[model samples]
Target: MSRTFQRALLGLALLGAITTAAAQQYDYDRQEQWQYPAALAQSPIDIQRGVAIDGDLQEVQSIELRDTVATLRIVDNGHAVEVEAHGPDALIRGRHFELMQFHFHAASEHTIDGESFPLEGHFVFKAQDGRLAVVGVMYVEGEANALAGEVLDALGDASEGEIEREDIAIMLPRDKSYHHYLGSLTTPPLTENVEWYVLDTPVTLSADQIAGFNARYSHNNRKVQPLNDRPLVHFAAH
Candidate 1:
């Protein structure tokens, strides 16, 4: 073989090896149906969830929520325990979005000042105008959470069905100070343009509650993605 041809072949081999290595780093089997690591705007970005930043956020707004008890539907999808919630719609930044669903994660997805909590809950919403927003609540090992117990018991049944909605208002922290940003769903299709609001105050869940979730779905958290020049704002609903 000519020296020039040999060099070209060596370069091609190296390129192929690099590509394979990258593909291996992305767990295709573990990704939620359609998540691609190569996609930008992917979620669970590393965040300073409770800290203040200077001029990083473009705008901040208040949240008006109508918390009421309704029927609760739970889905055992194997990846995570999902709950369907219906109540009076919430007003976010002047847009009304219905509370669609909420799901759980072991440990946590977004890092708060580079620290991960014991568990996380994502309350997802969608507006009539086709806008999406999520409110993230972190959980730490402390006292047992009343609402978490209801979720755990429902999950324990190992069946997918609906039950009377146990009012979870007691679980919501009255203080609304939170970290705000724009990001996509942590799960696949990796849809972009979702607004994220991660509350600074963490709720409590007992050892048993955490264990129950872990027993069902050991770990369903998506790895944190790059922030990549995205803005973060500390918001407290007025």
Candidate 2:
């Protein structure tokens, strides 16, 4: 082969190698920059087509809470539970909208001044105006949660769509001490403008209950995101 031809071929090969390296570098950058809240930035709950009346939210009244229905299912991505709960109305900050659904996250989602916990459950809600408010509860392994314990009793297999009736009402503790912040759902299409209320006092669950739940799902928690230009509000302890 001619020397000139050989040089041209070698240059082309180098260019191809550089291009491949650049593409791989780009992918890594994307992954590194990915944030959980940025993934599920919007509420997953939606009203049924039949329930729509002039596309208004005021026309609606009450929304029933359910365990068998979910519009989105996000398993432990080693980061956060990707939720796509579907329903009609929920109650948030005293406003009645719809109780889309709830999911669990191992090792908690919010941290208190850089302190984290063992688990966190997010009860997502949506208003008619397309706003969101997430209720977060941190859990520690100790005495089993009485309410969670009863519900766990019926979760024989711990699989999705498993429903068990419990007499206890799933209500947050009366203590209003909380950490409020603006963020987004910790899942895909991570949207922003979400209101987060994290209970100051952490709940307790027995080791057995933790094991039972962990058996079904392990390490389904999202990495803590940067506070980033957002302000966190700490409510005075009641």
Candidate 3:
């Protein structure tokens, strides 16, 4: 074999290796092994009610769903089912952040007092200045949710597609009470400075609906991280 041909083969091999590495799936079971920022504000932290400070109703942030109907493009990004849409601006501690996209994680990410839920939905919003705020809604086993069913049906047998959804407001719990804290994205890079508002009240979803999602991406939740002395505040709706 010619020396030039051997070098070409070696270059192709290196390129293939790089591509494979880039496309590697996130290993949730081994997330502790993943590289993250040195910051102490990592997320999916267990919100301990005993340690949480009670705040006034005025302190509660408001999420205004301006558009009841949203055109959402859903995709199963191998890690989680992510939906791309905009609107539903959130007022968090006097700052405004607009919704960018939302995603799902099975077996809730942020636990409450060491208890886990069936599912957790993350509504990610970004400010004009590039800051991020996330609203997490927990789903418990109960009556089936219509919106959840629509999303599940749209995502059926396909990895990526778009679907229009009405009544996006139904996604949020009636009670606006929430646990507020500062944290980073649960996924790697794990960038800090994110504002998290995890709803205190959980919504309901039937067992079969939750099972439908699990059948696709089972066990996508990240283990709850340490609170690390951060002040977690519980804001009451009324």
lDDT of each: 0.77, 0.55, 0.84
lDDT by residue (tens digit), candidate 1, 47-68: 7654456432455466666774
Return the TM-score for each candidate structure: 0.79, 0.60, 0.89
**Which predicted model would earn the best lDDT?**
3
Global Cα lDDT for candidate 2: 0.55
Q: List clash counts for every candidate, in order.
A: 0, 22, 0
Q: Which ten residues in a row have the lowest lDDT in candidate 1?
A: 49-58
lDDT of 3 by residue, 68-122 (tens): 4678888888789888886556666667778888889998999998999989999
Residue 206 lDDT (model 2)? 88
Which residue pairs overlap in candidate 3's backbone?
A: none
- Which prediction has more favorable TM-score, 1 or 3? 3
C-alpha RMSD by candidate, in order: 10.1, 12.2, 2.6
lDDT of 1: 0.77
Q: How many clashes (backbone atoms < 3 Å, residues ≥3 apart in a chain or on different chains) does model 1 have?
A: 0
